[model samples]
Target chain A: SQTIHQWPATLVQPVGSPLSLECTVEGTSNPNLYWYRQAAGRGLQLLFYSVGIGQISSEVPQNLSASRPQDRQFILSSKKLLLSDSGFYLCVGTRFSYEQYFGPGTRLTVT
Target chain B: SQQGEEDPQALSIQEGENATMNCSYKTSINNLQWYRQNSGRGLVHLILIRSNEREKHSGRLRVTLDTSKKSSSLLITASRAADTASYFCAVTDSWGKFQFGAGTQVVVTP
Candidate 1:
């Protein structure tokens, strides 16, 4: 079965702290990877997407960045966390011809 | 501006009743999809309707897409308390970029 894995289900960090969240997919090859942030009581905002290794597209220019180091590995990182970055972060993998599946998601609380 | 926008920021319904939500997009799409997200959980894709399709159903869920109007609707029949969650509409463009709207929070009471 196709599955996506996200690490550090929840995180707490003070403003200005560095951040790193990882996501990996299994049972799929060359799947598109996407990063999204969801604010409380609001819809998801697309942050970044990767179509292939070393190629990334950012939807919003913010304090975060995404990298695809491997075919199945995607990472979201920030040099300094901001209070506004406190939100639920989700990793998604999509089959080129079909719908996307989500990882369990990482909840970041920047105080 | 976001590509898709869901109507009714919130909704409430009794168990066994039906729940419906609407989504409108700003541009033409290759397909539209609906997703459900439980509190503190990742989102689950519920259904997808292609631009060439009109209506599709999965169990008790029905989705209708009107490409001409750039709108879609999701209907859940016999909703249960467990169905309480946020429903989001996402659109995929020809390039496969997904854009989502603010979700509609559905509360199904027992």
Candidate 2:
């Protein structure tokens, strides 16, 4: 079975600080990866998706960006975090069946 | 703009009652998927129904798709308190990109 892992289950960063969230998948290679953000009481907004290393398709324009450094590793980074950047960030990978498997998620609170 | 819209923004039902939520989308879809999220956490995959399929069942959940009308519904039978969560409908286009709906919040009272 495949498993997705995300680091720093929770974080509290001050406004304008740099941010980094990492996600990795085990038991799979070259899988489609996605990053999503869900604001409180709102639907998920797609941030970025990568089909391969160094290839990213952004869905929404924002202060956040995503990178795929390795086959199974993805990172979400921001040079200067804003208050609006606080939300629950999710990392997802598509299973062989075409359904998505999500990581535990990282809750970032920028104050 | 959202490609899919789920009806009944919120639903409250008893533990033994059945809960049904509907989703409507624009344009053609290759597949429609249902997901559940607890609080503000990541979404968990529930079920997926291909455009060619009319209905599918898994455990206590049933999903029906109408390609002609571009709509889908999810039925949860004999719900439990643990089923209290927000449910979302996602549609995949021909290129396999997933678009999610606003989600329907379901509250199962015990």
Candidate 3:
């Protein structure tokens, strides 16, 4: 089983502030990692996904970016935050490619 | 978009009743999955049915897939209040890209 850990369970940031959310995986090596954002009462929007170290794919054009510094570590960053960024962000990890295990998630409120 | 669409956006039912939700997708998929999300928490994977599979069961969960209709259904038997949450259906294409539905909000009252 793979476990994903995310930091700063809840975050409050002002517009234009820099943001960095970290996600780390345990019990799995070289797992695929994903970052998704969900607005209140909406479906998840895939922000980024990584298949390996130093490789990241952006699903949508936005202020957010992703990095996989290590096999088990994935990071979501933004140089300048926007009010639209406020939402619930989720980090997911998968080994077999079909089933995904999610982290507790981070609630970001950008004012 | 390849996102799935869930029907009857919301549902309310009493405990011991059955809750069924339907999901329809736009394109062909390699597999379809169901997930549960409690308020203010991450989503948990509940079940997965491959394109070749028409039906599958796990404990209280029953999933049926119809490739021809590009749709799927999830049924929860003898529901409990604990089952109150948002349920989402995700479709994975052969390329491994996944798209999730807006979700069905289910309220199981005790």
Which residue pairs in model 2 clash with each other? none
Residues A36-79, candidate 3: write the lDDT tens digits. 89999877877888889998988899999999999999999999
Root-mean-square deviation of each candidate, in angstroms? 1.8, 2.0, 2.2
lDDT string for model 3 (B39-87, tens) is 7577888999999999999999999999999999999999999999999
- lDDT string for model 2 (B35-109, tens) is 998987667889989889999999999999999999999999999999999999988867666678889999999
Candidate order by DockQ, decreasing, is 1, 2, 3
Residues B10-64 of candidate 1: C-alpha lDDT, one tens digit per residue:
9999999999999999877888999898985777889988999999999999999
Q: Which scores better on DockQ, 1 or 3?
A: 1
Q: Is the docking of candidate 2 incorrect, acceptable, medium or high quality?
A: medium
Measured with C-alpha atoms, the lDDT of residue A31 in candidate 2 is 81
Q: What is every candidate's C-alpha DockQ against the true complex, given to 2 decimals?
A: 0.58, 0.49, 0.49
Model 3, position B86: C-alpha lDDT score: 94
- The better candidate by lDDT, 1 or 2, is 1
The best candidate by DockQ is 1
